[model samples]
Target: MEFLQQNWHWATLAAVTGGWLLIDTVRAKADKTLLSAVEATMLINREDAVVIDVREQAEFAQGHIPNARHIPFSELESRKNELEKLRGLPLILCCASGARSGNAIATLKKAGFEKLFNLRGGIFEWEKAGQPLSRGSKNKDKEKGKKK
Candidate 1:
């Protein structure tokens, strides 16, 4: 008590630092669930993971992963049934960056999606990682499908 009163600023600093450390420890567990581009690719290759793009239809139409299911965030709740076929598979959620996909993961979890992941840095990172993308022909096919 005497030392604390003499150095109250030090005591306050110590308390604040301690609190931050505790919170960071808890957050580490939640954030550890994140996957790098390479790890995500390996999971897709070996585990036959399914990619779910949570971007808007226009964004998806612009470009997206081959075989990735297009389910906009607004429609995810109503379209949960559509993902039933992918229940057991590793669901990789992606967006322009990762923010939308992160939110999508939580939304799906609440809707009882047990297997899911947010693409770390999303398609932006995938391109940066030098992964392949569909060419003109395949891109045309997906665009035509969305028109109907």
Candidate 2:
């Protein structure tokens, strides 16, 4: 007890850090806002949720979740109208990582999109989870060819 009393400042810092962590954990749990790759897949397959990839065109062409619509983060506000038809459906936003998608969520939320979700850890996590990604601009060409 003598050692703790002498290092009271250190003890206080540790306590504060631990308390902050506990609060953050509880807050995160209380808000089921971010969806994991598996949960995203379930939403896509079962609920027909609309997946919007917020990465840039080059990044998107490299690969993306199958059927995900491309809308770069920079253009989200301007291109938002294109998604109006899908407003009622769950809109899942994704980027290279979670940060950009989280920002996209705020943008969509301000536009009154209530069923918005951020892809937790974004495409990185999806690939890490072994989810398949649709690759290349050629795939789009192939899809168009099928329609003709």
Clashes per candidate (backbone, < 3 Å): 0, 0
For model 2, how does the per-residue alpha-carbon lDDT over 1-148 read when each residue is reduced to its tens digit?
A: 9999999999999999999999988876776778889999999989999999999989999989988899899999999999999998999999998899999999999999999988888999999999999887646758987999
Flag clash pairs in model 2. Answer: none
Would you list the clashing residue pairs of candidate 1? none
The superposed Cα distance between candidate 1 and the true structure at residue 93, in angstroms, equals 0.2
TM-score of each: 0.71, 0.80
Q: Compute the lDDT for candidate 2.
A: 0.91
lDDT of 1 by residue, 1-148 (tens): 9999999999999999999999977774577546667878888999999888898877887778777888898898999899988899999999989999999999889988887888888888887988765433445786888999
TM-score of 1: 0.71
The count of backbone overlaps in candidate 1 is 0
